[model samples]
Target: MYHDCTQVLDSDATTYPDDPPVELAPHTTFEKDGYRVTELGFGTHSGTHIDAPSHTEPDGRTLDSFPIETFVFDAVLVDCRGKAAREPIDRTDLPKSTGGDLLVFHTGWDAHWGTDAYFDHPYLSAEAARWCADNGYHVAIDALNVDPTPTEGAGDVSGNAKDKPEGVPAHHALLGTDHLIVENLTNLDGLPEQFTLDAFPLSVSDADGSPVRAVAEFQP
Candidate 1:
């Protein structure tokens, strides 16, 4: 069995405030004596998306350069719900002997999707991203990000006022290592605490990221 990880993009779908919102345009209407056709415009990272290394690394590989095999692999789930903000999940959080190349985090943040709480949610720490990088965990979180708010600061430090003030250390740690970062996943709570995950994105050439259709499967 499989569960879709892709978000249904609509007028209400969440996106980076700086990016242009998703919009649908009709190129040819069925009633206009033509075939049904539509044009979609949105940021690459608009929904349940995968961030390629190039998303953060200037010299990193693009989505088209990624090997097809990279999209298919074994996976392990690490559930860290109820954990403190910006918790660092080291090797201990993972299975003792996971054979899969992919590591997925189930933080139960999907419940807050479409709400302001979702954007303000906590994320994995830089150390957690480092751990995944060092251990060869190909993919990362399904939550907002992997950084926390600044512990000591009166004014916003990061340029983006809407983003967390902790900076993009998580992006640097994970994306810097050429690991794929999947964000804004939902329905992870329905999955078992531990299971196999499969995630794939559209093979868009030269794209920094693309919405993925991720899924988890386990024997009942």
Candidate 2:
């Protein structure tokens, strides 16, 4: 059985407060032209998208640089919604021997999508990020960001800090030469502990990130 783990990309959909709002223009409506076609516009990281190392690291490889095999792998899901807002989840939350498995963290933050609370969701600890990297696990999460909401720039965040560090410690910790981060995932509650994860990005040349149709298929 396969569970779709992607968010709907639309004008009304919730997006990271810092990213551009999704927009579309139909240039080929049947009323005017032959058929219907749309020109979509949104930030690369908008909606259910995967972040490449280049998203954080200046010298990191872009999404197009990764081999096709890196986008498919066995994965394990962890429930850590019990973690508090504005706090890091404890490293003990992860299973041992995560080697070669994608780790998808279900924070249940998707419940807050389209609300003020979405911006204040909990995040992975820098230590946890490092642990995943150290154990060779590519990471994905169902949160607006892997890092805590930024200190500034995101508008109307409940606890916007004037001095919130611009630094994304968790992103920095998790991103490597070929790291993958899938943000704003939903429907995680129905997935089994183990599944086959396929999260391939568009081959936009030198793209920092791309929207992904992420999914999980469990064994019978």
User: Which candidate has the top score in lDDT?
Assistant: 2
Error in Å for residue 214 of model 1:
1.5
lDDT of 1 by residue, 48-87 (tens): 8888888879988788888776876577777777654444
Using alpha carbons, what is the TM-score of model 2?
0.90
Clashing pairs in 2: none
Residue pairs in clash, model 1 = none
Candidate 2: C-alpha lDDT: 0.80
Model 2 lDDT tens row, 1-220: 8889888988877776667899888979999987999999899998889998899999988888789888897888888878766656769888865544688888999888887677777787778888887777888888888887863434344354432435687788777635578889888987878888888888899998999998888865
Assess candidate 1 and give its TM-score to the true structure.
0.82
Worst 10 residues of 2 by lDDT: 154-163
Regions of model 1 farther than 4 Å from truth: 84-98, 148-164
What TM-score goes with each of the models? 0.82, 0.90
lDDT of 1 at 190: 69
